[model samples]
Target: NAGVTQTPKFRILKIGQSMTLQCAQDMNHNYMYWYRQDPGMGLKLIYYSVGAGITDKGEVPNGYNVSRSTTEDFPLRLELAAPSQTSVYFCASSSGLSNEQFFGPGTRLTVL
Candidate 1:
């Protein structure tokens, strides 16, 4: 089974383009999160979901959104992409609140 998966490993977008970074896992995790990593910086949480129909914004939620409609899928939506939003996005999942998170490979996004 795929632990976690992300689509379009690499993408380049115009300044105003919009896209959705898809994330899915077959582990049936209860906690899911979206994070972005800038060069030489630690990961920053953008959004998260504890279960289906429950979503919350994290430290940096501007220009991004997320929805959790199922236990195995959580997608991050970037509306009106910008150069500041260019970063490597990661999707992670954990079975419980205190468990270690399993992260997806990552989606590299470039906005020019």
Candidate 2:
């Protein structure tokens, strides 16, 4: 799969629980990113990786964490999930920062 793929598609989380949203791509991309889209809204960056072992936090990284140990994977860890964390998550990848990304379908998470 050269394109990014997200797991579970949808999830329900309790107020203080945790979950890891999986993301992966086989396109040999150097830039991988995680973003959240509010209900019917645009996307907001959460984290990004330029390559293996090089990761950076994006605009909305307060509730999430990411690691880039391999070029094919860029997973997001949500610890002590809160109601504010409930949103649709998307994983995207590009050959480089100057390039356009290929987006995955999305992971919809709800906190109750």
Candidate 3:
């Protein structure tokens, strides 16, 4: 089965610019999430959605936003980006809160 897919494996964004990271899965899962991993640091949650029309902020939701309008798509938005936001972003999904998540390779974002 096709798991998760992310675009522009690498990206460079100027400070104060904006971009959207796309994430899609064909696993028919119900839980989707966005997270950022920095050098020498663990992943930090940005946002998650339980289902269409339902969304919630995670640990480090600042500077980012998300929306879930369908079962297979969950996109993350970065507005007025800053250097601190520079990190590798990963998109993951699980069957439920207690299920093990499957992750995409990742998108490396560099904000200069």
Candidate 4:
């Protein structure tokens, strides 16, 4: 893809279930990030990677995990899903913090 791409546009999970949200970018960006947006709220960062094999927790990283094994892929793992995890997740990539980030369509997740 030319920009950021995320799979599974929508999903529903039972409590305690787990799923992976896949994200990729073909632009060879050095910075990638995951964010979650709750109803009536702005996007909150979950995790971010400055480059492959380097990652750090953001404002909200609980119950979520991320790995950056390659420049193009940064996948977020949700383990033991809970109702509190329900939100719209987005992936973004950018050449640098000063540059604009390109976002994916987003994955809407619901947990009961």
Q: What Cα-based lDDT does every candidate model obtain? A: 0.95, 0.93, 0.93, 0.97
Against the true structure, what is each candidate's TM-score?
0.98, 0.96, 0.97, 0.98
lDDT of 2 by residue, 22-63 (tens): 999989999999999998889999999999999998998997
Q: How well does candidate 3 match the true structure in TM-score terms?
A: 0.97
Model 4 misplaced regions, further than 4 Å: none
Task: Write the number of the candidate with greater lDDT, choosing between 1 and 4.
Answer: 4
Q: How many clashes show up in model 1?
A: 0
Clashes of 2: 0
What RMSD, rounded to one decimal, does every model reach? 0.5, 0.9, 0.7, 0.7
* Model 2: colliding residue pairs: none
How far off is residue 69 in model 4, in Å? 0.5
Best-fitting candidate, measured by lDDT?
A: 4
lDDT of 3 by residue, 2-57 (tens): 89988879999999999999999999889999999999999999999998889999
Per-residue lDDT over 4-111 for candidate 4, one digit per residue giving the tens place of the 0 to 100 score: 899999999999999999999999999999999999999999999999999999999999999999999999999999999999999999998899999999999999
Backbone clash count for every predicted candidate, in the order shown: 0, 0, 0, 0
Model 4 residue 98 lDDT?
A: 98
Question: How would you encode candidate 1's per-residue C-alpha lDDT over 36-67 as one tens digit per residue?
Answer: 99999999999999999999999999999899
